[model samples]
Target: MAPPVEPDALPSPFAGLPGALWLYRFDAAGRAHVLDATQCGIDAVHAPDHWHWLHLDLSDARSAQVAAKLPLPDDARATLLSPDSHVNLQLDEDEAVHGAFVDWAHQRGVDLAVEGQLRGDDGIGWLHFALTPDLLVTARRQALRSVEAARRAVGAGTRADSPVRMLELIAGRFADTVERSGDGLSVRLDRIEDRVLADSIGEERRDLAQLRHQTVRLHRPLTAMRRVLKQFEQRHPAYPEHELLPAVARLNQRFDDLDGDVATLQERARLLQDEVAAKLAERTNRHLYVLSMVTALLLPPSLVAGLFGMNLPGLPFAHSTHGLAFALLLGVASSVVVYLALRRMGVSRST
Candidate 1:
């Protein structure tokens, strides 16, 4: 076995790698094992037909060790020690390594993306890697609260029968993340709905905009995870023929459930958006109605005022002692007539 590095070791040759993850490989007995690499002692640990499961912290050498555990193509072996920016790019350094990892993932039917930000907002996506008779690799980009809790459980040696159980644990964390997010989303949606109803246009607009952006941001990684689980369910890799299938199948089911929850959330957000828009439109219509009434009430009085204010000697009502009263009466009558006309025309009160 290669010597273990201390946690505080000042950056391995693999340091500063974006999306860095630590990978731990375990044998069928749940004991640690190493992957294959052409580098000196690395090739010796992974002989022909050995199977292992790997646990990875996305920001450490955990992935490097797992890569070494694979029965890599020559190119993959070559890229193992040669540091690069992305883990996926390892295959670019050698077609064989690319083919081996790609084919292996394809055979196992894992829609795994080793690098790239999982949209940055849904936290990081995670998967536990397992090859029944060959290998297992679990990976994530950053420490998620749920993932950390699961990791503690694993480290405490709580019941992880095989890699499949660990997968369930990881999936459990993902489920919790979704649940927590759902709770938060529900609160926000409730508040927004209240605002929308309160007829506060500015506040309602901001809330709706925020809700839409948040929903879209949160939806991306979960959608990707559903695809990953679907991929996992369809592929069959060499593993212990005894019981791994059922475990993986169950995990796939959980993934489906998670997908359903995400879809439900998306639908709710859409409904909220439509409601907000309709309410805003209603408010706008009310304002427009009020303005129209005010303009109508002012039009006749304005004309009368203009005509009487003219300095012509014979202006109508200029010389009458009741001029002000008559003008007042005319204005009142004009307003009454206009109001009746509007009522007859089906105009509703707005303010």
Candidate 2:
């Protein structure tokens, strides 16, 4: 047997590489064993039939150093250390696959570009990864939710003999989080629809707006991911022979379905938004109708008061002893006449 592993040893060739976070190895029997810390050389770790995975934090200052020390192909290494957040997968001439993917993550002072997070509104993070036959490497500026969940699953003895399989597992975990979010949106839609039917959308316009925004955020990245994966599959179907096709196909199908669901939610929100606008317009029209009727009724009385208040020499009520009473009666009669005319014309009738 090999010597007992040291807990404090770092994956070596470069001393004190702080970016390295987690390391795992699969033996010839294909079981995952967490290598807490290792001083092992990359070549020694990659001997004959073993598979290894190293996860790193690119937010750390040693990102370049760690990428340089990786045994991955140059293109794969570049992908792992790239600070740009755009998603793409490329197959290197050496048969390594590398890409950046959008992943959900909580924020904590990451030293990376803005696009890496979930549109800067949600905690969406980018996961940059590269995979070879015997090794898988993933680096990210911020901590990702799916990456951590995959670690948990591995701790629970999840078996993935290949880097492709591990990648699939991490993607599946991400889909699980997305499914929960979609289900929540559906539930919220049901409540919104109920309120719409009951005519009690007190603050639901604003709520629905937030829902639509979240759906858009989820939709845009998912679309780019699905589109790029499909394009990669169609164009470069031969390289990475054993694993790439099925993995891309599976991810494409899963994300396509998810993108469809988000699109549906967006459509539903649009329709509800229109309905809310119509409802608000109808309410405004009713209030305006009431106000116009009140104004029409008061118009004649206002005219009578204005005419009486003008201090002209030959004002009709000015010489009468009962001038004040006559003026008051005239104003009341004018208002009543206006009210009767409006009633007769059906202007006061409820719709």
Tens digits of lDDT, candidate 1, 65-181: 545545655453444434332213111222121210110011122222221122223333333232333433444443444445555555566545454455556556555555555
Tens digit of lDDT per residue, candidate 2, span 226-250? 9898899888856646687789889
Candidate 2 yields a Cα-based lDDT of 0.81
CA-lDDT, candidates in order? 0.52, 0.81
Worst 10 residues of 1 by lDDT: 98-107
Residue-level error in angstroms, candidate 2, position 90: 1.4
TM-score of each: 0.63, 0.84
> What's the lDDT for candidate 1?
0.52
- Candidate 2: list runs displaced more than 4 Å: 1-18, 28-30, 108-121, 239-241, 310-329, 343-351
